[model samples]
Target: MRDLQADLAICEAATPGPIQMKPCACGRCNQFLLSITHADGRFDPENAKFIVEAREGWPEAIQRALKAEAEVVTLTNQLYNCGKAVFERDQARQERDNAEDKVDRLEDELRMLQDALNQRYQP
Candidate 1:
């Protein structure tokens, strides 16, 4: 199988502007064609580095692949964010539990000190 991207890259490097497609007009059978041309749609056969015959449905397949790739990227980002949020929530819960434990210890110490003072001053 031919590497479409590599072929496109070579054509792009050899020419200026974006790649364009049009129906072949070389007196041959009706077929779609690919070529690099300037924005004004000017094509020079002498400077043409390469011309590819685009098979039917090739363009649509490329578009679908591009859309699928974009969706994959978006889903990957969302997964990462969800993992981060879970980690942060667990960390916050741990910190709150530790704080509560410290408060309980302080309250117990305060009660003991009050009892000691009362006994010392009792008749």
Candidate 2:
């Protein structure tokens, strides 16, 4: 399984700003560009720290992947909880059986002692 916590940590540590997509204005073939803008709306394409080429369907694909990851995390946690619950239930059942067996043995001992006393008194 992928480490969900690590992925969350990475996202938390990423650039604290909004991502922007702008059209390439070099008068060349039509293309789109991507960049992370600071909180104050400052952007520098020439000195961008990180840049990614925007391809058709890339954004949608990324969104789908994120949704899938979230679902995986939720399902994995539920599965772990279910397994733990089953183990606890089994443990409780074993303890109950042990207690019932102990009670039966004690009852048998009491009956034996009672019978012996009755025989002695009759004699």
Give model 1's TM-score versus the native structure: 0.54
TM-score per prediction, in order, is 0.54, 0.53
Please report how far candidate 1 places residue 74 from its true position, in Å: 0.7
**Candidate 1 per-residue lDDT over residues 1-123, each given as its tens digit:** 456676566555555647567776667768656565554555565335444323423564587779899999999999999999999999999999999999999999999999999999999
Off by over 4 Å in 1: 1-54
Q: Model 2, poorest ten-residue lDDT window?
A: 47-56
The best candidate by TM-score is 1
Supply the global lDDT for candidate 1: 0.71
lDDT, candidate 1, at 9: 63
lDDT of each: 0.71, 0.67
Write down the RMSD of all candidates, one decimal each.
7.0, 8.3
Give the RMSD in angstroms, all C-alphas superposed, for model 1.
7.0
| lDDT, candidate 2, 38-83, per-residue tens | 5454645432322322232346557778999999999999999999
Residue 3 of model 1, lDDT score: 65
